[model samples]
Target: MAVGEEQKRSPREQKMLLADSNGQNMTALFSPRFKSAAAMAGWDEEALLLASLVVEDTPDRDSKHKRRFVLHSKTPPTNSSRKRRSQRTPQPVAILDLDEEETPRKDSGRKKKGKKISEGSKVEEGGNELTEKNPGVSSSSSVLPCIDKLREELSCAICLEICYEPSTTPCGHSFCRKCLRSAADKCGKRCPKCRQLISNGRSCTVNTVLWNTIQLLFPQEIEARKAAGILNGRQQAQNLSPESAFYATLMNRSTPPSGEASGRISRRNVATTTSRTQEDEDAALARRLQREIDEQSPGTTTRSRVHNARMRARGGISTSQHEDAALALRLQREEFMQTYRGSQEHVSSRLPSSTLARANLRSMASRAMNLRISDRRR
Candidate 1:
């Protein structure tokens, strides 16, 4: 029966049995107990008989057990074999499976067509494809609100607009440079925001980082502001008198003209010309008053005495360094009038108009003298 079973086994099973027997032979040959027994018995007849019986019995039992286990534990068909069999087999055609496979492609095609139509409509209506086509413009549009907030934060407190040529004060407040300068001129050298004293408002340096940021974010606004400022300056220059216009031009000139004197000399010349013009006007007024007084009282000792007193006052006023020359001359005229009033108490009642006229003329003369002395000092 064993022989029949062994013969009935497949060729692959028979090869597996031979490989198992060879492995068992290798393990037993190398085992310590077999080596020790061989050293002591030296291949005895009894040991050879026992080994033969053990080998024969073990193979029969192991072969039966291994064969049963291998047959029972046979692996299921692999994925590749199952897939090949599925492909070869004729499956039933279902309407639902066909529709499901085609649905995604149909939906995707419809979506693409819809997108094209929408884009075409947008282009036709807006006449601008930048928002859709240009990635950079779209990205920038997303942050537009942030940029606007930044612009508000960077705006000048004085002008209530985005700062052009931004300047920071010692108190860390910022404003447009032109606005800051104008504010300082109008309301003293103090920060418009914080009311902190600015030691040198004229010398406040531009905040380079803030300026660059403003330029970067608000280039169009900055250009517009600059153009407006230039236009305003031109309009002011046109409206100004020739002397005032010349002075404005002189002050605005960043560099001196070729072969011209320095700014200090030009400024001194302007001062001298102004003083001379003022002095000429005062002299003309004094002469006109004197002529009026002479016509009113042709040969009055009061007029002569008043004229002498004025001459003496003029000499003293010219020499004195008092800033309030006008007040001093007025005081002197009052003192002289009091003395005249006391001396001419009887004559003043007979010619009250003449006395009043003389007093008025003396007052005018004193004012003229004051003007001349002030101009000379200037």
Candidate 2:
């Protein structure tokens, strides 16, 4: 069958021929039966490929075209006829005068200003102090709800307290600098609030503008917190042991012993000293931890060296063991030599000096000499 004959076939017959074979003919050109059928029907690779796509698209395309055809056939004509208007009598137009005011009894601007002044005077002197609100002015103390809202905004999510040395994440969440550092180092570099990736930067800075605003708005709260922190710190310091106190003292002293002789340190000096002390203490702690780690995980060579040193100290495999071994070998060699000489003397005395006897004695001597040499070597 040629392509022209295939195209000439009725639509019903073509659908029947192209009906799906349970997806078995999906590789039409690969399968021998389908390939022969396609070749007989005058299809090339390009035509087969194009036909495959067409077959896959046919159902959707046919349904869409059918819908469009039905709509086009059934739809009413849009060329509507124009309607004609009937002639009617004209209505008279009335114009109102703009000379007179619409509201004749309205108060003048001067009267309004006078009334506002009178109201202000009444509030100042005649009105009850609490009830009347000053027209344009509001006291901060009265706006407690607004203050509370602002405090909430300033509070750190990690601590649930007002942010001290506040650090802002890329995700727009804010936390205290110390709290953020601890979380990033221990938990993860991802943000806790929004779980966005956070940069690992050395500097954990406070938002200065936010800090100043918070300080101004909540001065009392900030002062109270500072006082509480100081008290707690003093208590903890007092609780520390003598050893800890000694280290703390060493850390705190930034200058030489001679500098301590000068009396009356200022508050600024004390704060500076404490900050320096913290840095020193942190450095000392890191060094101590590193030392402990090195000691715990000593290298193979170091471990072997230590083991050998201990063995030497305990007299294990010493010079005395070596001396005892040498003495035992000397005694064994002497005993063997004495036994061999006795055997040789006995054999010589027992045998006569005749030709047969001499031969026998010679053989016995040779055997004894060989045995003695072997025993001495052992």
Candidate that scores best on lDDT: 1
RMSDs, each prediction?
Answer: 38.1, 39.0
lDDT for predicted candidate 2 compared with the true structure: 0.51
- Show model 1 residue runs off by greater than 4 Å: 1-143, 240-378
> lDDT of each model, Cα atoms only?
0.57, 0.51
RMSD of 2: 39.0
lDDT score at residue 111, model 1, on the 0-100 scale: 82
Instruction: Give the range where candidate 2 is weakest over 10 consecutive residues by summed lDDT.
Output: 85-94
Per-residue lDDT over 1-378 for candidate 1, one digit per residue giving the tens place of the 0 to 100 score: 998666545544544454446445544655688766766877764566456646654744455456558788466544553243234312122233467789998998778667655643543333234445764552222234465577679999888999888899999999988899999999999998889999898986899868866655555567678768866875688497543443343233212331122433354455645544443444444357545434322224576456445545877753343324435544654554554445346444554322343454456667555555554555
Model 2 steric clash pairs: none
Give the per-residue lDDT of model 2 (tens digit) for 1-378.
Answer: 797565445543533344434134456536788788878998786667667857765654565457558788466433421110011111110011222342332445456556655544443343234335664533332244455676678898888888877888877788888788888988888788888888863467888756655555555466677768755764576478543432343223322231321221332354557544544444444345333323322232575347445546768673454344335434533443344345446547753112232233344345445543543343
Per-prediction TM-score: 0.27, 0.27
